[model samples]
Target chain A: MSGVKQRVPQIILTVVALLLIASAFVARPEGGSAPLGPRLLAIADQEFATWFSILAVFAFLMGGLNLVATHLAKIRERGPDRFYSLVTLVSFLVVLVIGTAKLGGPPGLQGDVTAPGSWLTAVFDAVLSPLHATLYSLLAFYIASASYRAFRARSLESSLLLGSALVVLLGRIPAGRHLTAWIPEPLAFLRVEELSLWILRVPNTAGQRALMIGIALGVIALAVRMIAGVEKDPRSGGDGS
Target chain B: MSGWFAPGTWNIALVGAFVCAVIVFSVIRSRRGAMVAVRPLPPLLALDRAVADAVAGGRPVYFVAGSQDLDNMQTVAALAVLRPLARKVAEAGGRLFVPTNRSLVMDNAREICRRAYLDAGRADLWRDDWVAYISDDHLGFVARVDGLIARERPGLCVLMGFFASESLLLAEGGHHVGAVQIAGTASAVQLPFLVASCDHVLLGEELFAAGASLEGDAARLGSLRGQDLCKLAAAACLVAGSLVATLADVTGAQPWLFLRDAFLNVFRAG
Candidate 1:
């Protein structure tokens, strides 16, 4: 009895997953030509997708509560990072109030929260956008630092990578094309641009495709394990049987 | 037939079923005591070491589940790895912090961590705040996590899952903090950044295999074996198809062309 009770939830999960998969693959003919089964499956798929979206919205709400609780605890503790937590809380509340109330919009709750000149819109454009852009700008410096480390000719592989990087970098510029312009038409493939293109189109593409195929197979296997209930359920909090 | 399968998807359905059958069969066989072996993944070993070191040194271990939501397959695989690692950390009395950008992922991660601690018989050590949602905004999450990494200076940073442009910032942040970083993701675009910045990297499908490799259990190993078999079959098909297509193109042979088209139609959607 205990085992059966434990298996109940897993059975339900598996059934729902199988239903979703079947609905996704099964065909639905157009208009009245569609059979009842396929048509029902299509409707079930749409309903399930909608249900998932609704659940996601609820999850978002739960996350907001979690964020508030966490920052509030930090503030209560008077830790060194309490000030930042306070700022986060205040900003969250301000945005939530502004967006929900549709403040600074045309008027009334019917006005769009993100309408021009709205408080939320101003906050997004003036504060959030700039902050996002500033963080994004840091990527340039990070890339430079990463490249410096990656391009060091410490090993054969690194040397090859460095050589390829140099070719790809130079081939993208007009100077590289000019340098190779003197080459005969019969030897045009030896030009920097041609070589770079070949390197990208051939070896690079092949490697990426191989990786993609491997990843795809991995995904399929993992999905099978999950659907078959062979994998451990993290929510159960116990080691696998 | 068209009415029984979605247009342009019958081939996909057939392939999906075949893959599923292969994986399921392998799993059942292994469960019945069939032997399965997987190649060693160095990053998983490094991860174990990092956890032990953190426990001994009384420092925190940071786990970043990347910027993707739980819906992503990569996030599922990342969470799978987190289960054993979290349990190990909890058992050894080491602090593990997981900062997530997506709310759903954060919730799922918290459950996983909580379960880990419970299984370790150290439920008291589990804290809901350990897996916190920073922000859904990409850069905002990165900035906050970067600050956290700098301030905490964790001994180990385990970055696993799907990441985008912020991959380097996070990895470099760990590097600057002198943390032993182990990063894994299937994102081709970000692999280079991770390879450059982390101590150990799991490239592409290796991320998916990490959990199974760490677990070393029959079912998981069998699944891994199943994936390998599928990969071999795919390679064989690719080679055969290429040969047939090339012969048809070079020789303008009607028989070769027919054979190639028949083979292609078996795999081609619609």
Candidate 2:
């Protein structure tokens, strides 16, 4: 893999990737509102996309191999953290064997490894599903704790936070209308539900959108850096020696 | 028949104007020897060094690729940091432990680590166990990762990615362990917790750019530049739109709806 032959393949692959990427953006799609160039680009884009997707699959395979090799070596070295390696290998092999042997399931279109009564389904439902539920469930406790801590009335911002939270929390609850029912028709704007709606639509949504915009900008900057290859991965920046 | 700018042209023009203004300002500043200097990579390197040292001293470096699939930009950012982090650990002979809630992420992390190690010529040191997949259950994953941290007692822990309430529990646990922690997330909800507990917190865009900042890749830089350009354009449009709407409201003219529709159409096209 370190020889000149490897370099040749790498170079070829790089060239192919560059050309495809270029084509995807440069050529135009046909018979649309877009220009001829753009139409050509669209056709080229589909072809490039398909090829790129296949390449990604290969990348995934390469990654899987690396994963297996890394763990296998750990087991062989009997490293102090070897138990971790053991667990990893066990999990990988169990899934791999189950998938290949189609264990606990009947075959389907592509050999339904995921068919009912299959170990895959069992693992997914019993192991994976429960795990997801449990992790998601933690949000309840975390949200409560965070709310208590964040809702403290320390400053103007804190007051706003507490106020908004109260409005929303109360509005959603059955107790809100009962509490606000005494308000006159003209003052009905003070209803908890209406207040909550206003807060969400005006303040909460506005803040969320602003944050989203900032995030979008940041992502663009980062993408430019990567595309320019100026932001080399530190690992690759090391001396080849 | 409409030119590129058309009614939507104002936004692009505004961005162009801003850039021109900045360049002119920068030139003037440079001539006066008052040019602002920027060093973007040092903080990331320092953080990496801190993470590496912690991992090197027989303590694992805890890393989570957020609660997202690798496709998410935040997840990619986490992996970018992980690449250097894993190498530093490999070089220092320390372990890098990444417990992923997403199976695909485990795959991505493994690839990134392997590439890092191979780049370092210490591919032999990279282990699959280094990036393990726990339960996909968010809380289950959190519990398992937390347990791993408790048992491993890593010197440094980094929680970066799209997070929610689970982020708090993880950060709090890291705090309890007395590990030096660095956290980054786009989720504003989790930012306070990370800031409260982690030694360093990458907020919002900082999290998005952390990966690109770690590397001085021109492509990534260009993307950042493009994004900034887009943002400038957006801001200009925002101001213009607001003014137009206000003016239209004050007078009998109704240009505001046209501008709004134009903006909406442009955004929809994008």
Residue-wise lDDT of candidate 1 within B1-270, one digit each (tens)? 448677777678888888888888889899999999888998887777888987798889999888888778899899989998898899998899999988999988998898889889999988889999999887888999999999989999999999999899899899888899999999999999999989899989998888888878899899999888889998999999999999999999999999998888887855
- Per-candidate DockQ values are 0.76, 0.28
TM-score of 1: 0.96
In terms of lDDT, the best-performing candidate is 1
Task: Give the docking tier of candidate 2.
Answer: acceptable
Model 2 bad stretches (over 4 Å): A1-40, A52-56, A59-88, A152-159, A238-241, B1-59, B67-71, B79-144, B163-180, B187-200, B211-233, B254-270
Tell me how candidate 2 scores on lDDT. Answer: 0.67
- B155: Cα error in model 1, Å: 1.0
Error of 2 at B80 (Å): 4.6
Which regions of candidate 1 deviate over 4 angstroms?
A1-6
Evaluate all candidate structures by whole-model CA lDDT and list the values in order.
0.88, 0.67
Model 1 chain B: lowest-lDDT 10 consecutive positions:
B1-10
